[model samples]
Target chain A: MLIAKVIGTTISTIKDPTLTGRKLLILRQADIDGVPFGKPYVAVDTLDAGVGDLVLTAHGSSGRQTEITKNRPVDAVIMAVIDHLEISNRVTYRKE
Target chain B: MLIAKVIGTTISTIKDPTLTGRKLLILRQADIDGVPFGKPYVAVDTLDAGVGDLVLTAHGSSGRQTEITKNRPVDAVIMAVIDHLEISNRVTYRKE
Candidate 1:
């Protein structure tokens, strides 16, 4: 999963049946250091992420692992809000 | 699919079996306007694309379309080079 920030939401009154009732958000992807990366892309929100929250994103078929996105038109999805991350015995981030 | 420019190559002494003999190139993705986007990422070359060539990329399962990448551990791969692009009522690019 990649780190991203929730920037906005898209209104989709009608969408793929599997996506019904799931929230979708426009997330700006970020690097491991929390630096923004690339153009904004839409991601199905699974972790109740809100604007300004840092989120973990999953892509490819794995993004559809959730029942709400399974076999759906979804590509990217938020899976978790990282409270902390450690790499090689280094503390990278801790939720403030 | 996204547009990208081949910049360099990575030499892998060994890789997934299906990737044998296929040339892989490191491609830098670009926006619709040919502007650079995000950090550099690698992509397998399929169309004999060389450095500085603006190419078309396919992601997800589709990126594994070729026999070289089929059933292999591959994600981003370049499928074609964009000689031109047209969107709306305007001509966007033409091979120089």
Candidate 2:
């Protein structure tokens, strides 16, 4: 799983049939502080995460474990919305 | 799938029991000309690919679709060894 931030949304009309009606979002991996960096990637949004929301994404086959993403060709999925992050006993980030 | 270059090997004494006897290799994504870039990642090597070899890796559940990686907790697999890469009408890279 990766700590990531929902950066934006994707609207695809011609895609795998299994993906019809699915919500795909753009995300970037965030550090422990919830600051996103690196190249952007797309993931299925099972948790209704919106832009600017910090979330946890499960990649690979694990992405398909969700009810909404099962049997789909997509490789990444937003599985959890982060409420806060703690590291070494200190709170690094909290949802606004 | 990603075009990648196998950079090195991994020797692990303790890991998932299912990964016992599996060969893991480090790799970096490569460009159309087979020049590698980006952070390194580890993947199960079923094809005996060596360091500096250009290969194609399957990610997510697709990584587990291979007989050697099936049901394992691994997220990446070197499934194909690239013979060459062609874009448009030109051969960008060929195995040496």
Task: In angstroms, give how far residue B4 of model 2 lies from its true place.
Answer: 14
Candidate 1 C-alpha lDDT tens digits along B1-96? 456667888888788776777788887766544555667888777667788877655568656655456667777676555555443334455556
lDDT of 2 by residue, B1-96 (tens): 456789998999999999999999999987667788899999898777899988766687767766788789988877556665544345667888
Chain B TM-score, candidate 1?
A: 0.83
lDDT of 2 by residue, A1-96 (tens): 999987655433333445568876667789999998975556789977888899999877788888997765556788999999998999999999
**CA lDDT, every prediction?**
0.66, 0.77
Q: After superposition, how far is residue A16 of candidate 1 from its true place, in Å?
A: 28
Q: In model 1 chain A, where is the ten-residue run with the lowest total lDDT? A: A10-19
Query: Looking at the true structure's interface, with contacts defined as alpha carbon pairs within 8 Å between chains A and B, what fraction does model 1 recover?
Result: 0.05
lDDT of 1 at B53: 74
Q: TM-score of chain B, per candidate?
A: 0.83, 0.98
TM-score of 1: 0.49
Predictions in order: chain A TM-score: 0.81, 0.97
Candidate 2: Cα lDDT at A85: 93
